[model samples]
Target: MKYVMVFFFLVLSILSCRKNKKDLINNKIIYNELIREAKQFYRLNDYSKAADKYEKAFKLIGGINNTKDGYNAARSFVLAGDNEKSFNCLFELTKSELNYDSYDYIISDTIFKPLHRSTLWNNLISKIKDNKEKNEKNYDKLLVALFDTIFNEDQKYRKSIDSIKNKFGMYSPQLKKHWETIHRRDSINWKKVKMILDEYGWLGKDKIGKQGNNTLFLVLQHADIDSQIKYLPMMKNAVRKGNAKPTHLALLEDRVSIKLKNKQIYGSQLMSKPDGSYYVLPIINPENVDRRRAEIGLNNMADYLSNWNMTWSVSQHLKMIDSIERKKNDIDFK
Candidate 1:
C-alpha cells in the first residue's frame, strides 16, 4: 500500500511538470502571435492599433520587467500620437532592470520626434543619462550618424520604388530608370561601407552595440553578392562567438549560395515565380531545414514565409523538389 501511494504521487508530480511545461509553451506562442500582429499593424500604418497591441503584449508578458517590450510599446505609442501612454511606457523602460546603454536611439528615432518638443522628453533623457551604467561605452553617437546616413538613403530608395509601383504597377518600364538611379546610389554607399569595414573589420556588438551591428547588417544585406560572400566567414565567426546573431549569417550565406546557383544550407532566401507563387530557393537539406532554422532562433519556415504572403509546407516542398529532380533526370536521359 505504501509503495502504491509513492508511485501515485510520483506520477502526479510528473504530470504536473508536463502540464507546466505545456502551459509555458502555449504562453510563448500566444506572446509571439501578439507581437506578429502588432508588427503587421505597424507595417500597414495603423499606428494606434499597433501601439495598443504592443502595450497589450507587454502587459501580458509581465509588463514592468520586460524592458525591450516596454521600449517597443513606447515607440509605437509615440508614433500613434499618444503622449500619455508613450511617456508611461518610456518611464517604465528606464526603470526596468535591462541596461539600455544608448539614449541616442531615443533622441534620433523618428517615432520619438513628436516627444522631442515636450519637457517630459527632456527630463526623461536627463534621468536616463544620469542613471546610465558607469562602464557603458559612448560610441552610439558615431553609430547613430552611420545609421542616419543609411536610413535616409534607404528611405529615398524605397520611396522611389513605391512611387513607381503606385503609378504603373510592379513591372513598369519606368521602373528601369528608377532602379538604375537607386543602384548607382547603392554602389556609392557600398563603397563607403567597404571603407568602414576596412577600418573596423565587422562591427560586432562589443564595438558598436546591437543597434549599430544591426545597421551594419542592413548595409551588408544591400551590398552586392560578392561583398556578402567576402564577409561571410567573418560574420559566421562572430555568430559562433556570440558577438552577432545567427539570422544575419544565415541570410548572407543563403543569398550568396543562391547567387552561385548552389543549394543553401539554411532556407532564408525565397524566389518568386512569374505566376506570383513563392518557393524556398534550393536548400541543401529541405527535410531538416526547420530544425536548423529553429536552432538559430528563427521561426519555422511556414510562419516566416507568411510575412511575404507565401505559404509553406515541408511535405509540399519535398514533393516539389522531388518532381524537379525527376524532370531533370528524364531530360538528361533523353
Candidate 2:
C-alpha cells in the first residue's frame, strides 16, 4: 500500500527517461487502471489476485525490477503463501536498482518479517546492505539524519488528530490543543529545514535519499505563505531536474494558489471550516482537472479525495464550488 501511494510520481520520472513516447499516453492509462484494480483487490484481501495485477502493471512500466512497488508485490506474494515468487520479485529488485532508501523500505515493511527465517534471507539482506552502502557512500550522513528527524516529527502530532477528536469531540479544547501542538512542531521543523536550504540550496536524492529530500517539501508546504512562496521555485527546479516528485510540486502549487485566493489547478487543496465540514477549493476547469492531474502522474481526483471520505462527482464538485463562491469569507484557507 505504501508503494502504491509512492508509485504515482516515480512513474512520471521513469516515463520521461524512457526513449519511446510512442503510445505513451495509452500505456499510462492502462497502467493506472491496472493499478486501481490491483488496489481494489488488495483492499478485499485477495493477495494472490492483487499480486498478479500488480505485476502486470509493473511490467507495463518496465517491471518491478526498476520500481519501489517491487517490495509491495513481494509483500503480497508472501501474504499469498508464495515465498518463491516473493524471493524472485525481491531478487529482481536488488539487482542494480535499489538504493539505501529502498533498502529501508524493504526491511521496514513488517509483512516481510517471515522472510527472515528463510536460509536465502541472509543472502538478500547482504545484497541490500551492499546496495545501501554503495549508494549512500557519498551522502551527507548528518543531513540525512536531520531530515529523518524532521520527517518523523512532522507527523507526530497529526497522527493524534483522530484519537484526540474521538476522546474529546471536534473543536474541543483538547483537539484544539492538539492542533496547537502540531503547529509548534511544524514551526520547529520549518526552522531546521529553512536553515538546511540556506546552507545547501536544495539537496538532491544523491545527497539525502528520496524521503529525506521530501522533508524539504513537507516542511515548506506546512510553512507560512512567506516560506512557501520563497521555496516554490526551488522546488519547481528540483522537479525539473528529476530530484523531486511532480505530484509533490502539484500539491504545493495548489496550496500556494489557495493561499493566494486563486483557483487550484490540480484539485489537491481543500479547506475545512470551523464546524469541521470540508469543501474542495475552487479548481480551474474542474471538469478536466483529472486530466491535468494525470498529466503529472497523480491518481484521478476521485481517488485522492477518498481519504477524506469525500466523493468527486460532477454534481458534488459543482455544489462545492458554488458554496465557495457564495460564502467567500467563511472558508479559512480559500
Task: List RMSD in Å for every model shown.
Answer: 4.7, 10.4
Predicted candidate 2 versus true structure: per-residue lDDT over 52-74, tens digit per residue: 98889888877763455677678
The model with the greatest lDDT is: 2
Q: Give candidate 1 regions above 4 Å deviation.
A: 1-19, 44-49, 64-81, 99-117, 124-168, 172-182, 272-279, 319-334
List pairs with backbone clashes in candidate 1: none
Candidate 1 lDDT, 262-326, residue by residue in tens: 88888888876765456887677788988999988888887687666567777787787788889
Give the alpha-carbon lDDT of every model.
0.74, 0.80
Give the lDDT of residue 161 in candidate 1.
Answer: 70
Q: What is residue 32's positional error in candidate 2, in angstroms?
A: 2.4
Q: What is the TM-score of each candidate against the true structure?
A: 0.73, 0.69
The stretch of ten residues in a row with the least summed lDDT in candidate 2 is: 97-106
